[model samples]
Target: MTGRRRWSTDEILDTAAELLRTSDAESFSVRKLAAALGTDSSSLYRHFRNKTELLRAVADRILLAAMDGYRPQGDWKQRIAALALRLREAFGEQIELAVVWGRYGSGGTGSRLVMEELLQALRASGLPDDEVPVRYHRIVILLASLITSEAGINTVAPKEYEQGMEQFRVAVLGADPERFPALAHFARDIRPLGADRPAAFEDILAAHLAQIEAQLP
Candidate 1:
């Protein structure tokens, strides 16, 4: 609002979103951003109130990008799985941005809207309208949890994370060769860690969606 030169909101947002994707919020300061864009830091103030507002816009814009060009067909369950995977893939590409997303307004408008759209799709797919919201909440929780977990693992102690997964495997499937022979035998292969986790998450989510579809029909 202060500058004579006109810059579209989309342009500003795209610039900010790109920064968020590549750098941590702490590192991506307004001064540095202006330097990167070859503009004065004060000039950005015309487009955004402050860094917080700019970050919100960035998160929203990235969400829009994630949801864009997504055209779904076939059974709704398949479509939903595709949508979830697309979002996960997009977020995975920008781990820092994903962390921002996890922390934004308990994860912001863009995220909430995506879930709403998925809930509507579920309802259209024969799920009860009222039930859709709760079910959708669960799915988003799982998705957000996975993203947050990955972000945490990347930032914190990697060794502790590996240990935690090992413990989880023992807790969930147990280590009882006498009683749960198969789980005890296959536990190592069943609970993979580190980089393999995201794929495992997608597979588990897809299976859940398939089960929901199975229940519907």
Candidate 2:
């Protein structure tokens, strides 16, 4: 009992976060994390029971960090949109962890905060009790969509990302001038990633907000 543990959970989580930032999902491993900490996987297991538990804790830590300055404001719709955007930014910020929890469906306490606020926002709409659950689920789906998507792959896998970009350029940017008139006409605007993706997210969020507004008396 007198001996100090090799590494604390906070330290392990921080180190794991740093690894995930640079390493893609396929490359990141418990062995790599232990190596980074000048220890071994068993040492990490000493603190966490298993890999799934460790990943959930890491995702929880990142989610909590993403809410560092969050304070609810504005009306119901604005408040809901804000929560979505904040967590979207959070998920995008540490998507590797997001992929972990998304696969396992372990959002834990950090996601619960958003869940609570979203329910409040739906209630603030004054809709009948029957309507709230469905809308709440839709918003959660919108938020979770970023996890399995290609939104944040640029940081984790630059080479593969660039390759995908090149393929898009060939397909859309370099399409035939005559056979596909619409694509040729909007060639410049059809590029992937960049502002287009976030704009699309905004469009979806705005549409969802409008849906909520339409239901209000």
Candidate 3:
């Protein structure tokens, strides 16, 4: 890679996303990206207004990749469930990307497309028109909160801390039933630390959809 070579918009976004995935958001900057591309920071300004815009473009790329080849099938609940899982899978890869999305808001074509699909799925669920927006907001907020929680845990918690928590949970579950009856009774249903993330995410999405279904006429 030479500074003499001109980079296309797609190339810049792809490289930017790669940089984001490899590094933390606090350390990501237009200058850093330019240096990585063997170009000057000013060159990025032509494609993006600033670092925030560049990150948004990268986030859109991730969203598009996640939605690629995904078609909503089955009933509305099923369709929404599938879309939610796709959202989780897409942002789950890079926590910073998800955080960026929340900070800057999704204004790209990819965001619009996904939002439309989500609203359509919600409508198909037989939810009342007046309540659609409320439900939509709820779903979006839920996804963001869950992604943040999962990402924060991964980013801030060391392996030793996680292991210690697991050990404590085990100890609590193994306590005498006389003193910790509730813990002993539900021990089998508790998820261990570092449990299958995708599976747990899917379960959350499924439960959300089920709740929506219950509200339907």
Candidate 4:
């Protein structure tokens, strides 16, 4: 079986994901996939009973990648921020995947396991169980919002979005040399730098974590 062409669940999921990304997940059909893979559509039915099952498989594949290499380090807040960043990076890489991920209730094994670990860490840090729920919710919402934001991704091409942001900023803030001193002073800082992203999000999340920790007991 060393050189066999038999497809495993992992291979099928990966192929399905590639298909989803190339097109939309809702539009991807098992028949089409079967055609592309040179197999009968019935072969797919053996692994996945239906499209819903296949979608779940695809989700697991993405979540496994999202949760890969994630480990708690530093203080509880810092650890949560790390998890948040990893989730963001994973979702940001695939917009459709992100949409699907955000749609699921926070009860899947991957999400639950991560939540349990985070709650344990937070509890050990002297945070109450009730507070842990709220804190985790806030962190997830912040990360999801940040990752899905059009503004954040639009800021990707610095020279392009930065100039656009600058023009908009000036018009909205009414760039008065004397009145809006701080805005005038930090104009360049507001302008995006091609290199300032990805890592910049981490820094922002770090700051948010600190603010959250401050609110906790």
lDDT of 4: 0.68
- Stretches > 4 Å off in candidate 1: 1-6, 38-42, 105-113, 151-192, 210-217
Estimated TM-score for each candidate: 0.67, 0.80, 0.80, 0.66
Better of 1 and 3 by TM-score: 3
* lDDT of each residue in 159-190, candidate 1, tens digit only: 88778877787665777789878878786677
Weakest 10 consecutive residues of candidate 2 by summed lDDT: 147-156
lDDT, residue 13, model 4: 77
RMSD of 4: 5.4
At residue 93, candidate 2 shows an lDDT of: 72
Worst 10 residues of 3 by lDDT: 148-157
Candidate 4 residue lDDT tens string, 1-217:
5543667877787788787666655677898788777787888898988776677667655566777777778887777767776776676666666655555433456766667766766776677777878877776676666665633454245587677767676654567768888877776566533345677777878887677667767
- Candidate 2 backbone clash number: 0
Measured over all alpha carbons after superposition, the RMSD of each candidate to the real structure, in angstroms, is 5.7, 3.1, 3.5, 5.4
- Clash pairs detected, candidate 3: none
lDDT of 2 by residue, 105-195 (tens): 5566776776788888888888777888998988777767754453455353677867888888899988898999999999988757644
Q: Which stretch of 10 consecutive residues in model 1 shows the poorest summed lDDT?
A: 104-113
Off by over 4 Å in 2: 1-5, 147-150, 156-166, 177-181
Q: Candidate 1 vs candidate 3: which has greater lDDT?
A: 3
Off by over 4 Å in 3: 1-3, 154-193
By lDDT, the best candidate is 3
